[model samples]
Target: MADKQDLNAGFTGTPVEQPEGLAKAAQSAASRVKREAYAVTAGARDHPHTASALLLGIGIAAFGFGYLLGRSSAESSASYWR
Candidate 1:
């Protein structure tokens, strides 16, 4: 009985140690992200005009969304007062 209880004593959260595989997985993920970011940066540098147009479109869409949200809220509040 004591041996069976002691079998899981290590897993009772007395002291935790991270697995080597987990560390390797994290390092691999970080390296992949860095590579992707570098690729995007290089593409943007090579095509400034396209990047600017994309940014402008995103900004216009965001503004339109905000305007619609504000208009809807205002209409709702006006109806509530009446």
Candidate 2:
């Protein structure tokens, strides 16, 4: 046990080196994401009615699926008690 060194004793604040091209690839990916997000926002703004209708449909489908799942679980537990 005496031979073990403290874990924090070797710590240094220097930035770690990254693989070549990793930084450039990350920057390009970020820019692509930003462009896509901007395009989505512009499209939604240009077609508010379609976006709202799509959102409403998604909400209804999600609620129905959740309701079915909950109902099935409740029925199974009730039957187990009997």
Candidate 3:
């Protein structure tokens, strides 16, 4: 345990070497993400009606789910048996 601690304490904080291929892969992934994001944004901007309908549908679904959960919990917690 003492030797392990000494070994850990003697190490200098030097950065580890990374392969160039990893950097290239990361950049390619980032480029693809940026392109996809731009496409989505452009599509949304071009089709406001579709985007608004989707947003409204999602909101209504979320509200309905929350309302059901709240009602279930309230019913379960009530002392009807007593």
- Best-fitting candidate, measured by TM-score? 1
Q: Write down the lDDT of every candidate, Cα atoms only.
A: 0.88, 0.88, 0.87
Model 3, range 1-82, lDDT digits (tens) per residue? 4675566656587548753798879978999999999998899899999989999999999999999999998898786755
- The residue ranges of model 1 lying beyond 4 angstroms of the native Cα positions read 1-26
Can you write out model 1's per-residue Cα lDDT over 32-65, one digit (the tens) per residue? 9999999988999999999999999999999999
Residue 82 in candidate 3 has what lDDT? 53
TM-score of each: 0.60, 0.59, 0.53
Alpha carbon lDDT at 82, candidate 2: 92
| Cand. 1 TM to true fold | 0.60
Per-residue error (Å), model 1, residue 14: 27
Residue 26 displacement (Å), model 2: 5.2
TM-score, cand. 3 vs. native: 0.53
RMSD of 2: 11.9
